[model samples]
Target chain A: MWYVKNALTRKNLMALTGLFLSFFLIIHLFGNLQLLLPEAEAKLQYNWYSDLLADNILIKIIAMVLYLCIILHTLDAIYLTVKSKKAKGSGYVKDRRGRASKWYSRNMMFLGSIVFLFLVIHFKDFWYQFKFGELPLDANGNKDLYTLVIKAFDQLWYVIVYIIAIIALGYHLLHGVFSAHRTLGLYHPLYSKIVKYLGMAYTIIMTIGYIIIPIFIYLNR
Target chain B: MKIHLKIWRQKDSQSKGEFKDYTLDDVHQELSFLEMLDTLNLKLVKKGEYPVEFDHDCREGICGQCGMMINGIAHGPLKNTTTCQLHMRSFKDGDTIYIEPFKAAAFPVVRDLKVNRSSLDHIITSGGYVSVDTGQAPEANSIPIAHEEAEAAFDAAACIGCGACVASCKNASAALFTSAKITQLELLPQGQTETSKRVISMVKQMEEEGFGHCTNTEACQVECPEDISVLNIARMNYEYNKAKILNK
Candidate 1:
C-alpha cells in the first residue's frame, strides 16, 4: 500500500494523448485533402494556402501548442511504458498462460513507433517542402508545392511506404482511442462497448483515408 | 506439465526465509495453478512433511485471498486472471518455477506463501463505506440509479481485495484496490450524500497506510484475476481532485 500507483492513471494518460492526436489528425486530414484535387486546382497556386497559414499569428500559436502536445504525449507514454514493465517484473515466472489483452493493445508501443517514423517522413516531405523548399514556378507561375506532392506520391516505393505506415497508424489508433476514453473517466458500462467499436471504426476510416491518397495519386498518374 | 519451483520458506513472522525446491509429477494440464499447488500439498502431507500454508477461500478467483509470486510473476504470467484461474496447461513439461508470498513493509509474511493483508482491511475500515443506517431495505427502483452507473459500480466492486494489485505494483501501491472500494460506495444514492467525505477520508486513510502515488503503470490490471477495469482509478482522481479543490 505504500508505493505502487494503480493501473487507472496509465489508461487516462493514453486516453488524453489519443484524443489530442485524433484532433490533430482531423486538421492534418483537411490539409492533405488538397493534394487529392486535380493538378490545376492543387497546383503551385495552392502554395498560397501554406503561406497564409504560416503568416497567421493565431495559427502559429496553435501550431506551437500542437507541437507541445505531441512532445508531452510521447514523453508520458515512455514513462508509462517503463513503469508498466517494472510492475510486470513481479510476475517474471508466471506459468506462461492466458494473455487476455488484445494484441494491438500489447504492441501499442511498437505500432506507435512506426507512426512516429511516418510522421517524420511526412514532415520532411510536406512540412519541410512547404516552408523551406526551393520551388520552381508552375504553369500559373505560383510556387509548385502541388507538383512536388504529386511527384513524390507518383513513386511506387513511396506509395507503398505510405500505405504501410497508414496501416500501422490504424492499428495504433484502433486500440488507443477507446482505451484513452476509458482512462479519462468514461467508465460507463452501458456505452463502453459502443465507444470501443466506434473507436475501431474511427481508426479504420483514418487509416484508409490516408492510405487511399498515395494510391489514388499513383494510379491516376 | 512439470515445473521447477523456487519457493521461499519461512517458519514464522520473525524468521527469515530461503528458497525450497519442489518437483511435481503428472501435473494435469487443465488444473488451475492453485490446484497444482494443492496437488503438491497432498504429496507433502502423504510424505509426513509440513505442508505449505497459503491463504485461500472462494477459489473461484473473486475472493482475492490467494496470491503468490509464481515464477516471479504476481499471479503467474497471465493477463487479467487470478492465480486460481490460471491453468497449468499454460506451462510445458520440465519447467522450473519460483513461488513466494507478497513482500512489503506493511504485509508481513505469515507463513509459507501467505502474507498478512490486514493493512488493506485497515484502509477499508478507516472509511471505505458510507454511514447509512443498516435497518431496512430502501425501494431499489425509486433511487433512480441508471443501469450504466450500477453496472460500472459493480465492476469496481468485483475487486476481492486480493492485494494482487499491490503485489504486482513496483511500488506496492494499493491505488487500484482503494479506488475500487471508493468508487463502489460513491456510486449509489445512499453513497452520494457523503461522496466527498467518503473519498477524502478513504484516500487520507490510504495515504496514511503508506500507499504510493499512481504512476499509471497497468501491471495490476494485467495480473488481476477479476479483470477489474483500471478506469475506476480515473474516477477516484476525478473525485479526489474535485474534493481537494472545492474543499468539500
Candidate 2:
C-alpha cells in the first residue's frame, strides 16, 4: 500500500524495473551477437546457446523476473502517464516550452510506447515461435531459433521494423538510464556526472549493437 | 516601440478563459515587463475598460508573486529571470507576446493572469520547517555548520516558489519546489530532529495536492528563477528513500 500510495515509491518501482530491463539489454545483445558468425558455425552455436538458456534453472528464474519487470514497468508508466495528463491543466497558445528541455526527454512515454509495441511483435516472431510453435531442429538438435531469426531479418520490411524499434529503444534509454539513477537518489555531483556519460555511452553501444544484427543478417542472406 | 499582446483573460476559475488582443505604441524598451503591463493597464483605465489583472508585489524578483507565461515560457524567454525582472528590451519592436497564467490543475486561475497558488503553501504547511521551541533566540554560535553545508543549504533556500518549475514541467510536477524546500532544511543540523517525519509528511501532502510524479525532464531547473539544481530533487529522493527504509 505504501508503495502504491507514495509517488516516490511508484517512481522507485519504475526506476528499479527500468534499470533491470536495461541490464538485460546487454545480455540479450551479447547472446544475439552469435548471429554474426559464419552461417555454418552460427546455426550450431546459436542453437546450443538457446538450448542452454532454455534448460538452465537460473536463466529460467531470471527470465521470469524479466517478464515481471516488463509488465510492472509498462503498468507504472500507464499509471504515471494518466496522472500527468490530469495534472497538466491546460494547453498553452503559441507554446515554446520545448526550448527548455530535450525533445526525447519530454517524450519518453511516446518513445516507450513504440518500443513496447515492437516488443509485442518481437516476442511473437521469436520468443513465441521458439517456445510453443513447432520448429525444425538445427544440426545440434536444438530448436533452430538462429534460422528463425535469420529468416525474419532476411525480409526488408521486417528489418526496417526492427531498425525503427531499436532506434526508439535507443532514445528511450538515452533518457531512461540517467533518469533512473537520479530517481534512485544518486545525488553526488561527480558520480551523477559519471553515470550520465556512462548512460549515454551504454545507450549508443546497445542501439548500434542491436541494429547491426538485423542489417548484417539481411545483407548476408 | 510598438508591441502586440495576446493576454489570457478569465472572469473567474469557473469561467472559460480566452486570449484578448491589444496593441501598445510608444512603449519604452527599458521598462520592466510588469511596468509595461502597468502602462497598458493605465491606458485601458482611461478608456473605461477593465484593465488586465495580474499578480505582483515588491516589483522585485524575490517575492515570487509575479509569474505568468510570456510567449509560452514561465516568466518569458529569459532563463533564470522572473517576470518582474524581465525588461522590454528582450523583445523586438512589434513583437507579439502571448501572456497566460501558469496552468496546472492545482493552480486554478482566480482571474486573468492570477492563479490560486495556495496549493504550494499547503505543501509547506505539511512540514517544510523544523520543530523549534518558542522561548528565545538560540545563541548564534551554538551550532557550527560546515561552510559547504551552509552554502548548499542557502542554494536550496534560494527557491522563490514562483511556480515556474511546475509551469514549465510537462507533467506539472512540483518535485523541484518541494524538494528544494525539503533539502534546505534537511541539510542543516537543526532540521535533523524531524527529518524522517518531515519528508514523509511533505511528500504525502504533495501527492494529495494532485501534482504529477516527477519524470526528471530537468525542465524545472532550466526555468527556475534561482537556478535551483535538479540535484536537490535527487537529494529529496535520497532522503525520502532513507526515511521510508529506516522507518524511523
- Residue-level lDDT tens digits of model 2 in B93-212: 989999999999989999999999999999999999888889989997989999999999999999999999999999989999999999999899999789889988998998899888
Give the distance in Å from residue A74's predicted Cα in candidate 1 to where it truly belongs: 1.4
Worst 10 residues of 2 chain B by lDDT: B192-201
Instruction: List candidate 2 segments past 4 Å from native.
Output: A1-3
lDDT, candidates in the order shown: 0.74, 0.93
* lDDT per residue (tens digit) for residues B1-248 in model 1: 66777778888889878788999878889888888888888999999998888888888877788888776667777666678888888888998878888765557788989888898999898778768678898776777879888997898888888887777665566878988998888887778878778777777776666555454456678877777767777677678657756983
> RMSD in angstroms, all models?
6.0, 1.1
RMSD to the native, candidate 1?
Answer: 6.0
Scoring each candidate complex against the real one, what DockQ results?
0.10, 0.84
What CAPRI class is candidate 1? incorrect
